[model samples]
Target: MDNKEYKEYTAADFLNDPDFLLWCLDPDKREDLFWSEFPANHPETFAEFRKAIQTVGSVRLNNFTLEEGEKAELYDSIMSDYRALCSRRRLLRRRLFALAAAAVVAAGVVVPALLGVFRPPTETDASPARASEIRLISGRQSEHIASESASIECAPSGEVRINGRKIASAKPARMNRLVVPEGKRADITLSDGSRVWINSGSVFTFPAAFGEGERRVSIEGELYIDVTPDPERPFIVHNALFDTRVLGTSFDVNAYCDSNRPASVVLVHGAVEITTGDGEQVQLESNDMFSLKAGNYTVVKVDPSQYVSWKDGLFTFSSGTLERVIAQIAAYYRVEIVCDPDVRELCCSGKLVLFDDLSDTLDVLSDILPINCRIEQRPDGTRAVCVTARTN
Candidate 1:
């Protein structure tokens, strides 16, 4: 489609177009046309979208109400989708070609967006950018990938490592994200000898080697860093949304693109200066935090132990609302959690144990929080569970 034609289209237009919506929602759509231009910048919105599709795929529509063998027909329909996806790798291997634009070898059978092609849109401010923009992602506003130059360095002896290889002075590669998903995490030592423990769902990217300049890295999700201090090369954590720059410090960043209300940076030790994507900047002392909320940032002094208890396998929420708490639990334990108005309205204080299994944590919460809850299998059974209840 031409730029003129695409400009006239609205999100609602394609949303209402069943065929287009299916293509948009098609888990296999070519990412070149959509994914990078749309979803890459808006993780939360995409997460919700994937959740809705999962809901639709698993929703229990009464097939038993249909004619005798109709139930089997419905089952077969779902099974066919599974089989098709399983055959993707095999088919991709068989009919593959090299493209000039995409240097990487590809089958060209799987759609681009669905296979993980991400790109920024052309018009940065276009509300709900066209499906084929180049710079900005619609839905959620994120800081653009700013500051491409940051170097790495070496301290005392060995400092950083990459892909199982150790470097005396580590210079991270330039990338938008360093995805260390579950079942995997990264361990890197900075020139300051400060170690970084990257959790699952985390990303970290920097130059492969730092030079005669500042040490800087950009990231998202969650990471625990122990900085090795070089008075000259200050370590800076840069994100489109917020930037935390410091020299020789330890801290954790949870800028998961989860919410706009507040992007958090918890300082463990030393001093750091935080700058927001909006150009707002603040300096945080050891044990203090800079939280970006609603165009403004609030600095709060906190205990380092609270921010990093997750490293030891305990998740804690100090006087946070139910929604944020559930988000943390869902990510930590890897489950979809939804709360009712009442449950969402509930505010939780103190701590919760995640590694102990879901039932134990639920038992502890239900016992103390005056809310009795239970999980029920959805009508359409695709390993879906919903938890609901009210204050006793």
Candidate 2:
């Protein structure tokens, strides 16, 4: 839609536009810029624009495709509700205008007083946003799946379905892989009722349904899982260097390949047995963290918050080096951070709530430590943050 037309478009108009619907379905950078700018420039229609967005989000969450008649019925129902809400608001606006006019007339005031009584509204403020699209690999074909499009509700009577089609039941022919890239996270519920929180830059692969003997899945990077209990079928998690076996339990795994640090698993509840590729085995209890460095394995007691807090938008650092801390930040925000040699080895301890923009996080870090952060534009026209020690 052009700028002139966008200014006058109603919520229904936006919902009817094919381009607007496509943007709502698969929002990329260009769509994001257009919608963000549209609201800012035409704040009077911001509420209506948000209504359209929410309506589309609700519809997208249902995995099944609606027939033409069913789709029309759904649209009519939504529009009916919107019309009711708009009617109520319009009545309130009329009453307010009446009251303001009476007051202005009594005071013999016109322009300034009326403007003060009814000021123009501004665009709604939005918080920091991270696109969390999951990539699914089925056989040789791969597709990016939006969170709304991926179905999580368990199907009835031993059926495994995704996007309204049965993919597995009792026996499965192939394994399906799901990937969550950097700066994004995803929550998925397996066919067996187990829930998984896949962290950023992680890969997980599992069958569509459980087999007769065991339930098994493979992983790369990190995952926080709450496995379903079934003593008959043991649940197993396979990683690069080790395998975590359990019947029913909750645990966090960190095995990102890019990190120089040791790969570790932190158990929150129940019991888990970790077996290394080199024939080493260890059992962990609650609040236990098993770390694998090189070919050696070690177990230690640690606070579960330090390992599992990322699911709640937190980066907990307990006596960590500056290099490791910066690496974590770079991975979380999908940004490049170049740390000077002088400051890479500086050790620090703090809890960082990662709810704000990346720049805000860097500002807080610079304030607490003896470092300076600068955004540098590289020769390739890309930007990265360079962190150097503050010289006196």
**lDDT of candidate 2 at residue 13, scale 0 to 100:** 50
Q: Write the per-residue lDDT of candidate 1 for residues 279-359, one digit (tens) a residue.
A: 777888889877776677788888877677665334555445655666666554344555544455455554453322355
State the displacement of the C-alpha of residue 338, model 1, in Å, after optimal TM-score superposition.
2.0
lDDT of 1 at 355: 28
| Cα distance off (Å), candidate 1, residue 45 | 43
Candidate 2 wrongly placed segments (more than 4 Å): 1-133, 146-173, 318-324, 333-336, 341-351, 355-372, 375-384, 389-392
lDDT: worst 10-residue window of model 2: 115-124
Go through the candidates in order and give each one's C-alpha lDDT: 0.49, 0.64
lDDT of 1: 0.49
Instruction: List the candidates' TM-scores in order.
Output: 0.48, 0.57
Least accurate 10 contiguous residues by lDDT in model 1: 97-106
